[model samples]
Target: MTEFLPPWPLLTAFVLASLALAITPGPAVVYIVTRTLAQGRQAGLASIGAVALGNLGNAIGASLGLAVLFSVSALAFSVVKYAGAAYLIWLGIRALRGGAAAADGGTVEAAPRSLRQVVRDGFVVALLNPKTAIFFAAFLPQFMNPAGSALTQSLALGVAFVLIAATTDACYVMAAAAVMPALRRAGRARALGRYLTGAAFIGLGVFTAASGSRAAK
Candidate 1:
């Protein structure tokens, strides 16, 4: 049997790549930013916690070769991708509606959401995201050592990804904190921000839905 462990050089490369990818602006980043700006730093942190947990699931799945299954099984991938897209669209619609309501003199609370709820929501949002699943499935393979343990390599790569993502998301929280006061002081501005965020979610959903079909590797 061939070993599936990654070499030190490959591990180094994977770590660097994972860190870079995590820092890049993406949907998760947007979600964290919007949540932080709308609620507060605490809410953003909560969402991050949720996202980390979700990513951990993906890591485990990938380690177990479920990501490989996703890559190979069109039906499974479609199921997950469509579900994620639909969820994003639903979230967008809700946000847009909420924005409209707020514009009409609805009271807006500045209070942050409970940590548990934020973590749960974040975990689902990140876990169900097909992009993340596919990414790990494809990306982790490049550095895989034929002589090492596949599970260990996958877990290691996943840990690096989660750590990098957490650090970057924390920065997003801080950035949102800088603008929280402004958002709270101007109801109309906040409403507009909410609408824009909703629009972004909608666009992401459409993009996900339209993403090309991929064969399992």
Candidate 2:
């Protein structure tokens, strides 16, 4: 499958596609920002670390063959998609019900989720995302070499994609953290984070629901 890797044209496309996807705001980004503003920089960074690690798992799964497995099974896809959606709804509802305010008077900490919990949450959120699976399956193949080792090439491209994604996501975390003081003064920053986190989940859920339609398109 060395022919699987694309030439210059495809390599260029892969770079551009990766860049665009990295910059797009999504559930992972939302979670990191919310955690940083609510629990403090340490908490936020921890979640970021967790998410980056999870991306690796997603990439590996794609390279190792989960992509094909999940892509062909409508029942499996539905199960993962609906579960993701319901989780998002739950996160959003949890945020809305919290009335606590942070000591800084700008944000509030509803309840401090443990580092383990946050990491586990981040893992599931990224792991269950069919988008990642499909993306690697399709996108990596574009840059693969047919005469080369298909699995090896896929693994390399997948790792590259994950590294790029992690770097961009970290930038988002820092950028969001930069605004912490200002947001903190509003006294509802924590609530806002919770709400946003919830929204991310819900939005992803909707995206998951629409994936089948999109695949057809």
Best-performing candidate as measured by TM-score: 1
User: Compared with the true structure, what per-residue lDDT tens digits does model 2 show for residues 115-177?
Assistant: 886777667666667656766787777777677778777877777777777778778778877
Worst 10 residues of 1 by lDDT: 106-115
- Cα deviation at 3, candidate 2, in Å, is 11
Question: How many collisions per candidate?
Answer: 9, 19
Scored by lDDT, model 2 comes in at 0.68
Q: Write the per-residue lDDT of candidate 1 for residues 1-217, one digit (tens) a residue.
A: 2354477788788878877777788778887887787667888888888888888788778778777778788889888888878877877787787777666777643222477766776777777765676677778879888667777777777777788889988997998899788777886676676777678778877877887643111
Q: Give every collision pair in model 1.
A: 3-146, 3-147, 3-148, 4-148, 5-148, 5-149, 50-123, 71-216, 72-216
Which consecutive 10 residues in model 2 have the weakest lDDT in total?
A: 208-217
Which model scores highest in lDDT?
A: 1
